[model samples]
Target chain A: MKKQRFDYGYILTLLISLVVALLIGAGILALTGHNPLVAYRALLGGAFSNARHIGDMLEYAMVLCLCGLACDIGSRVGIFNVGGEGQLLLGAIFAAQIGVWLKALSPWLAIPAAALGAMIVGGFYAWIPGVLKVKLKVNEVITTIMLNTVAVFLCQFLAKGPWKNTNKNIVAGTGNLPGSFWLKKLVPGSNLSTAIIAAAVITFLVWYILQKTSKGYEMRLTGDNPRFAKYAGMKTERIVLITMVISGMMCGLVGMFRVYGAEHIYKSTVSNEYYFEGLMVAMIAQYAPLPTIVISLIFAILKIGAMGMETAAGVPKQLYLIIQTIVIFCMAAETGIRAAIARNRERRAAKQDVKARKEGGNEHA
Target chain B: MHNNIWSTIFDPGTFSQMLRSATPVALAALGGLMTEHAGIMNIGMDGMILMGAFVAAVGSYFCASAAMGILAAMLFGILIGLFFALFTVKLKSDEFIIGCALNTFALGVTAFLSREIFGLSGTSGYAVPSLPNVTIPLIDRIPFVGKVLSGHSIFVYVTWLLVFLMWLFVYRTPMGLWIRASGESPETLRTVGKNPERMKWIASILCGVFCGLAGAHLSLGYLNGSFVEGMSASRGYIAFACVIFAAANPPRAYIAALMFGFFDALGLRLQSYVSSDLTGTIPYLITIIMMVYVVVSRQKRRERLAKQQLQRLEP
Candidate 1:
């Protein structure tokens, strides 16, 4: 039989699972002697409480979404690019260095120059593992993870030794770039700049490239079946290599945004586990770009709101991390839960058929 | 500067230090090799080690006994192993994703729980007493070997013993045969009425136990009974690499781990004299280069094989 087009029931299942997760989170908060209602209200109010807060959330979302997209590319190609933290870190350094060295250039020229530099360097950083996978068959997971360490060292060396902002009499950061190089802030009373527009545009472009292009189609095919694609004469090796390069470029964009738009300097601390969080966001979105953007915003909101939750309810903001972990556990455990449900339904259906025949016989009698 | 660096790198006292540093990686790698041999790719060794170390510290802290701490750590490892087996073996989930999830889960859970339980952010200090070093009488007198072998923590000796034991277990025993068969011939093992799934579970749990011990060694034996957030770092992945380098053989894995330890010790030594930051980057740099080298060599091998096949066809 031809199947019906839409399944409202499936949508309802997703909505219910989300609600259940939130309720469990609220229960945990209550057990900790904090009023979940007050905390949640504070979270909402704090995140969207003002224009400035909203701007911060947007900027944060932009950075995370780019990183998430970068990770999704690698993940789709069956490469776990755990090196987002490293790639982003290095990208920031490259972009900031360009901004620093070319301080005399016009804002428009220098900003794009810095962004391009970041993409190149970031993409190169990721290409190491891609090439290795194609050549040596060494797992990208280990290589990407190792590259993270290398990236951190490279950042530390630049920050402390050569790129140290010597003029500031402190050795922790790079020299600041010209104010002109900074991306113009679009929104008043918020650092949410025209950069958000750039982010949105890039996301759109990425979506187009992934969905509408033959290269993207080839990439998806290789990701799903490299051997089959090779049989189809698709140059699977080149596709694998290019996919990683693009992934790395996305990471570079994330780094460039953080430096040019927000921090305006490269620091070692930026090499933190933000990349892993980006990976988690990508996983939750199931590697779909649009969903990833939405998930990134949700993550940013939760992180931004958690502070207000802490102050209003006297619950530690670390509890937000706990909630995140629980959500991940729920996501990972989803298939198992659905299987159990399906098994139970099958058994119930079998019993119902028997009972239906008995009732029909009694009615005939 | 050259003299100072060379002296530090080649110092006689450095041998003992190297043993101390290498013990953790070697133990974890040895543990990972067991599962890898059984065709179970264990990426959660780091998480297992982290969980083991955290529990060891917690157990020792309240009980005030290092032995009890180690035992508790083992139990934690078993639990994590079971969780891993449930995902990879039973549910047929992606091992890589599950491993990543476990690492993330461990990081969050440990950090949050550490805060709630100890009112500390990353670690609990003085959770258990540190394991004391034991000097073997005959081995103590054997010059350089004695220096490296004797007067080390109990875990150090246990690690070496476990390597030998693992070698024997894999080569000499029936269970070892089953594990090998499971990885190489799953269908045949099933035909023999042995469940490959069960064997994989056993291997994973065993791996977990070793991982737990590795953690205990880090916290109670090495760090003087403290639980630190992200203490496992990327040692888990490094150990997995060691498994690959060793060709999934326990003895070879131990040797590969020692290589890591040698670099780790070299870094520590260099840190004493050079910039700490530069020295700290050494081990990570080596790991990257090593993996890349492995990849390059593998490519060469594939090309050579293809060339040989073409020559054969030409005849």
Candidate 2:
């Protein structure tokens, strides 16, 4: 069988699907008595209108991109590490706990230490499912999901009990960590912090590792075919373990930044959408590291724009989620579109061959 | 150890509470087990349950009839199942992504619709009727087993009946064999002229009906006809775990669901003595620990077998 060419047919299908989704969205707007055009304009304007809004979008993009990279690695290796949320939460909890506990250390050391600590915890958390899957034939999907529930409960337990913000002056959350360990603000008016740079750097590094390293090649091979890799004498189980660990660590790093840059405390009020959004980003990019960054940023822009849409056009702010879901659905359905494209190409090839045979017959006559 | 604690465990009142608590999850697990048996991984059982609850509440509110509410819930459940099947089977979508999409979509759409239809209260069920508990005549007066088995909603009894039904369906039926064959050897089944997709669809629709009933039980029986955001919580996933632990056996899955229900009840009781926060974590913590233990022991067993095989090869 010939390889399917990356062609325009699939892109056309994606475009068509997106248009249909947008039309459905417009119908929803009309039913709600909101002007679709106005909402669309406001959403677009809000996403890019001001520097601060752009910064928020960037902030959202940065964390999303980082998590997307982690997810991309897992997906490429066929691991489907759906435990990104759990890993992120565990990382955040660890970072906050360490930051709050270690009062003696200087800010620089403490911050890095907290981040590193979270990475380790997150990595270990992921490794459990990976090990279970490899050694015992337990399904990772089930394990990761169970682990996510565990992580949510753990976070809830810690925030309300041991780490209880104690001040009682605010809503339930953990007590504030040292102020000095907070990420340095990158822009004067915006919440943009040095963490964005850190996240971007991490994304780049992931791209490099996947494209340049021998281990990355082996990991990809393991994802593509474990039996084949085993026949080639690769330690497939170890690769699975390591791949999950790295995926978990990346998620932890995203959590580390969220704690340090945006929230500045371990709060249970963290968004539940991050994990799904990260998965969406990775999947939309077809599990490519670099493209993940772009897709995540685009999603961030939509989120920021959603505020404008709500305020000016009277559209609900949750419109961003609908748009995100539509985009992902279209992207995920690309496989079927590609198959159609292949069939089309095959038919076209057969027609051309028939014409060539007819021309050869004419020449013989 | 104390008299009160002992009473809580062995008393008829406690047993009744446990059965009532276990009913919804057991019902949902029965549905999930059917899907798993047919080789379709369904993570959207929670979404189906949530929709069922909402629809049941809406139907009961307008019609003021419990039967109407149940019928409405089943219809909604079947529709959602079709929605899931469309993506997974027809569109060739990844089951995991589609499941996640369905979950998020249900969350948003239900919340959005509840606001529009029921007003902006974030929940509704004002003046809605609830399921009346059915007490067995003579059995209600009997001791432990009577309390454990007698007083429950019609749905609860139905759930218990389903355990037997599912067992029979899985073990004693030709269709059950086909489902197992589809999961284990779809190609073989296809060669014998069976449509595996059709089996999966049947499994999905059945799962949907059960999950819908689970939701109905939650809103109508447990919460007294109220629908709230994410009210199903992680019960669907917990039921899914029960399916795993029970190895998809109906009777075993029922037992596992009961174990979860027991912990849920214990957590509720503990809430009064300890911080409500710590108490709330109990169910989730138990689930995790249970899964981890199950996974670890299974691994150890495999390792031991591998070791034994190696030792035999050494001769």
DockQ for the candidates, in order: 0.40, 0.32
- Which candidate number has the best TM-score? 1
Cα RMSD for candidates in order: 5.7, 5.4
Candidate 1, residues B210-292, lDDT tens digits: the string is 89999999988888767888899788888888888777788888877777878888877777676666777777767777777
- The TM-score, computed over Cα atoms with residue i paired to residue i, of candidate 2 is 0.88
Model 1 sits at a Cα RMSD from the real structure of 5.7
Model 2 per-residue lDDT tens digits across residues A1-365: 01124445545655676676677777777787778888888988988888877777888888788888888899767788888889999899889888888857899889889989989999998998888778766678767877787788778878877777868875656778787888987765666889988887787788888877888788889999999999999998888889899999988877888888888888864546587678877766678776677678877887778877777775666666666777667666666556657767887777788797875422110
lDDT of predicted model 2: 0.79
Per-candidate Cα lDDT values, in order, are: 0.78, 0.79
- lDDT by residue for model 2 over B118-198, one digit each (tens)? 665744537777788888899878777777778688888888788999999988998988887777788788879898888
> What C-alpha lDDT, on a 0 to 100 scale, does residue B155 get in candidate 1?
92
Q: Evaluated on chain B only, what are the TM-scores of all the candidate structures, in order?
A: 0.92, 0.92
